[model samples]
Target: MKKYLVLLVVPMLFALGCKEKKTETQPDQIMVTEKPKLPETVLDSLKNHPPEGMVWIPGGEFMQGAVPQDKQAMDHEKPQHPVKVDGFFMDITEVTNAEFAKFVKETGYVTVAERAIDWEEMKKQLPEGTQKPADSILQPGSLRFKKTKSSVPNLYDFSQWWEWSIGTNWKHPQGPDSNLDGKENFPVVHVCYEDALAYCQWANRRLPTEAEWEYAARGKQKNTIYFWGDDRSKLAQEANTWEGEFPVYNTKVDGFEGTAPVKSYPSNGFGLYDMAGNVWEFTQDWYNVDYYKELAAKNTIAMNPQGASQAYNPQNPYLQEKIIKGGSFLCSDSYCSSFRVSARMGTSPDSSAEHVGFRTVADPEMIME
Candidate 1:
């Protein structure tokens, strides 16, 4: 089972925006009502002229790991440490299907999910003598989350819900039958890390570093788990996350059964929408379980940390992984409570799924260049 599960290419398979020049502040109990003056070092024109559909994020020093109050934090999210991020511009929302379609139309770029799988390149990551899968199962497709008939006794086994359906691509989110019909405004899913990188390059933007992502997701809030404060009751209203039994029964209390439209919920203090959930966004950094601990041990705040040099996950050290942040609509109290600001998970750089997507960032220096 372990060998086959590892061969599935989905080990656990789990798991931005809008604004402009002004110091993004919303008068609310959760959002920061008043923002501090920007330092002189930050580019004066950075906030003045942002890219279209993008907002300014006045990044600063903040803790970048799971807070003490968060009980659902995994071992990888631990060892809270201070991190400093330079101000940058971020998309107001996750890159929408319409937005991605423009890139595809102009560049004729094809997403990884739209391409056939390769066995020779794949077997390199698997154990020696691993049997290759049947050709029928290798059709261009992706993993789709299919709810179970009833609640399962164990939630640890995610394969019970995730199915590797052939013909599952971005255009066909739930296998070949699904379409993007009215979901033009919806965040594009089934996008791999390489797919995201291509989109970013075309847009003159790049994936945000893990530290920068966490800092901005916090919405300038110092200690709260969720960007909308520590209260779990406000989750349904603040982000598009799972609201029911999960993987079995979804009550759709948040007015969504799957991926909701981008900005379907309230924006964080930084004017970034869907920072807590909706879809997991890819970051520039490689996933390292002990990277936070390494940062904490430095005894000084990390200055615009660029994440670890290499990927490291003791459980799945054989495969390279990249950090994916902000959880997704699949997150729920009963299952993955990863909607919290500091909460994070990683996935293979090559894998794509319905629950995962990405957003991009334009650095101040990069803009100046």
Candidate 2:
């Protein structure tokens, strides 16, 4: 069960065509742009020199879904399939708060979390006679995790720990009073898909397609439960997932109660850090629960699968979602065991949360002369 309350509000805002402005004086306005394509010459230079915090992932075919015997696997991750992905350069670590701050400071980008909700737009998602939420409740904010008082048997009800905290955004992750003081190196949270896209635009990069994200996360490891391999003992040493009971308490076995600094953990085979945990990263693909089945039905290796053209989740039919790869620090064996390389999740493209952030990718096509 993904959070739906936030999702319900996201599509409405997007439907209204509200854009974030990108001028130095107007930091609160939305800015929108078409996806960028890099020039061949620039791409060639990138291949040789590579970007400062990136690793080259060689192109290849690999198992792209849940392993045959993964009991924890969900139906959406099943029917393992082969996917072929081209080589590309991927961020070595999740984009840090410091990095996102630089983009915001330079571009004056206003993240979705910072914009006030439009009641008129929101009403479109409701029934004919439904009443609107109070103006105060519609204030600009983002979802943040709040530890539950006790263990929750129904892990599906994520509302137990996730709350829409008013005034919560990238600058104030927890609330209005909280700031990114010493956590500059921590992966920036409370960023929606648009915010990530804006950052990518500023950096001259793009979000990885779902196939690329999985391929890079696998890091050349064939059919392993995790990027490091199938060993559970190594999880604590290699990632920042929840160690104790989820929602209620965290044992901090991985030495992090919330998010650890980027690269605090060991890197995967391709030298990518925090690939398993830290934050759920956004991908450039619309999510469809049965998309894998559709691909498997093809019976041939999917050549650079770009993901579904439209989003669909049977559980929440109205909300549009995009595929988000990797799990977050909140992942727990008892709850969301999504740290596994093949695990998949979806959320509204305009929904931002404390457990979500993203990294960028540069495709090989860009370098092809």
Best by TM-score: 1
Scored by CA lDDT, what does every candidate get? 0.79, 0.80
Model 1 over residues 69-102: C-alpha lDDT tens digits?
Answer: 8888877888898777777899989999999999
Off by over 4 Å in 1: 1-6, 9-42
lDDT of 2 at 246: 80
> lDDT tens string, model 2, 300-325?
87877777755667665555678898
**After superposition on all CA atoms, how large is the RMSD of candidate 2?**
7.6
